[model samples]
Target: MSSSDRLLLILHIGFAIFTLGPLTAATMATPRFIRNQNLVVVRYLNRTTRIYGIGTLGIFLFGLFLASGDFAKPWLSASMTLFIVALVLLLIVERDQRKAAHLLETAAAKAAPAASSTKTGGEGAEEGEKAEKAKAAKPAAPGADIAQVERGRIAAMSGVVALLWLVVLVLMVWNG
Candidate 1:
């Protein structure tokens, strides 16, 4: 391999290791934070996923440079296809993360007033009894269920993306 190809290979590997590792970690961890209703951590993970996800494009670009227009190789083609699919899935994951965060935030906002009212103990005994019954019949907040559904989707999609990355890694090592 020439010096430029060597350099490209290094860059490609670097981006893969640095970006994919964190991206996978963030996506995997997001569901847990969402389940916990930790908005701050969820936002941080969302940012991490976005940044690292974009960084992964560097890996693809460098790999293309290393390929030097050799698009006919089966392994290269398959790897590229898998990478693209993974990217699409990651995009969906990103969207789901945003939605989950928004839902959780809204739930928190709505719950705050209800929480304050309950704490003040301003209601009559009958009213308090009725309120407690209503709270028991329902979840802590509206949209919490939807947020949980989003969490499940994010987890499943992140898993698939991680699997794709593993498959691509195997193809590169075995076929290169």
Candidate 2:
């Protein structure tokens, strides 16, 4: 195959991976911890958060390289346009994840009550402790649910991206 073809393949795979990796991570790892309130998993995703951004950057740069060049047939332009919009939607999805992550982190670090409380050796102290625990037990307001309606939007982005790839294939293999 030609160098351009090799590049296209790399770009296409990289872009798709970049777009879909967090989706998999969020969907898979999230459910594992959301119910249990696990910190390690959240930290794992947060500390390495740059992967999502860098992968997205890779997708934008590589996908544009593939699209702007006339490697594909002219009839595939509409498909390319869909791919572009799909990338945009993917970026928005990433932003929403970040927002959710931030909220989760905020909830986590403060999950326990402040340490300044006096646990004096008395029944009154026991009552105070129970009250504090009760107050802290209230569920935190999350920025977004992983299972929210926006997730549907994210899935639609993937579907559109797949559609674009199909269009490109059709234009190149069957129609060209």
* Per-model TM against the reference: 0.86, 0.49
What candidate 1 gets wrong by more than 4 Å, as runs, is 121-146
The regions of model 2 sitting more than 4 angstroms off are: 1-74, 114-176
Give RMSD to native, each candidate.
Answer: 4.5, 5.9
- How many clashing pairs does model 1 include? 0
Per residue, candidate 1 scores C-alpha lDDT tens digits across 1-176 of: 99988999999999999999999999999998897788899999999989999999999999999999999999999999999999999999999999998988888787767755764345565676687677656555644565878899999999999999999999999998
Q: What is the lDDT, from 0 to 100, of the residue 154 in candidate 1?
A: 96
lDDT of each: 0.89, 0.54
Residues 112-159, candidate 2: write the lDDT tens digits.
444235455667788778766765565444523533443455455545
Q: Pairing residues by index, what is the TM-score of model 2?
A: 0.49
